[model samples]
Target: LVHILSHSGLLLLRAGVQGLSYAYLTALVFLHISREGKRVSLPRALLTPVPSVPSPRRYMCSLSLFHYSEYLVTAINNPRSLSLDSFLLNHSFEYNLAALSSWVEFTLEKLLFPELKQITWLSTVGLLMVVFGDCLRKAAMLTAGSNFNHIVQNEKSDTHTLVTSGVYGWFRHPSYVGWFYWSIGTQVLLCNPICMVGYALVSWRFFRERVEEEEITLIHFFGEEYLEYKRKVPSGLPFIKGVKVEL
Candidate 1:
């Protein structure tokens, strides 16, 4: 009877956390829409307060905040790049899939083995990673203001120049480095071990390819200037050397 009671309590707790998560997301959406001078059709139920708890749902809110900040920073730094894509919430189906997978994994693990749900220190670390990574990425964007674009430029525009100051001086690809760590941090925040590992591996692979591809264009655009910058700074990602060029 005690065991059953404990499980029921856990279930209820999870429900409350999930409810709060939904409410938070709804509120954010309404806030965004209202800011844009659009009518907000928020449900009445969303206005009802829900008790919050330490859960994966909290991290999910963090993720939404991340996307919102990404949009806000772009709007400030590179207004020309501002568009629907600036939000980055629905940039790709895979992004949604990843978030879904993390939540599913966390839910299953929590339900089946409640003891595994809380790794306090690890979650704290994950939160730190999210905060720092987001800051770093935003800093890169600001430093590269006008030079930063959501998409890699194949053709160098007059405004485009090799950015090697600030975060760029620290990491050849500071924005990518920040984003790569930030992706893994989300899974870690959820305490989904499988998802954490999966996120790390996939993020590493994606950034590795992207860094190399972007560097090729960098070389084409700035020639010796870019090559010199590449030589001075590290790729900023673990085990990623980026493109090789003989000086």
Candidate 2:
């Protein structure tokens, strides 16, 4: 009974956090598109096409590759980002079941996997990782401000330059690194041993693929400048002082 109540409360908390984040992002996207006007097409601007402009065919070709790559990466990372509303309206019992299935992960990890559920320093470390990592992730976004985006943007229009200082100084993609640890830490804090492994493996692959794609896009956009920055900075981590990956 206590376990059920606790899980229920955690689910509600997760829902609340996701709802607030979605609302905030919606508001930010609306404001940005409203101000950008025609350079970025309406609604379609979400996909980021510049069809209204005359034939700068070469630029368009590069942009088309960029936009599609960004879209694919977003879809891969967040399969529901663009279509959650339609899903909400059409959801059925199965959908609710799927939503509630998180408890199964919780149960399996906390109950069946004693190796994972044991109390250890990892619990404290995981707690700190979630808290500090989340804060750092937010700070990276806020620091970059409007320049921050899930989609790669043409640097020509953004108000900020390549973020090579601050969080950027910490790692080339500090936000991704923060999120990577933050996610792994979630399973640790939850005492879900199986999920800790799953999270670590899954997030590593996702981020590795995503990071590689992003660097390609960055090199395309920033040329030698980004290459130089890449050399100077390690690839976003608390691997920070000691380790560096030259992605």
Residues 140-185, candidate 1: write the lDDT tens digits: 9889998988888899898888888899889999999899888888
For each candidate in the order shown, give its overall lDDT on alpha carbons.
0.73, 0.53
TM-score for each predicted model, relative to the true structure: 0.78, 0.54
Q: Candidate 2, which ten residues in sequence have the lowest lDDT sum?
A: 54-63
The alpha-carbon lDDT assigned to residue 168 of candidate 2 equals: 78
Cα lDDT for residue 202, model 1? 82
Please report the candidate that would top lDDT against the real structure: 1
Runs of candidate 1 exceeding 4 Å displacement? 1-26, 29-53
Error of 2 at 113 (Å): 6.4
- Candidate 2 accuracy as lDDT: 0.53
Q: Return the clash pairs for model 1, or none.
A: none
Candidate 1 displacement at residue 38 in angstroms: 28
Q: After superposition, how far is residue 97 of candidate 1 from its true place, in Å?
A: 1.5
RMSD of 1: 13.2
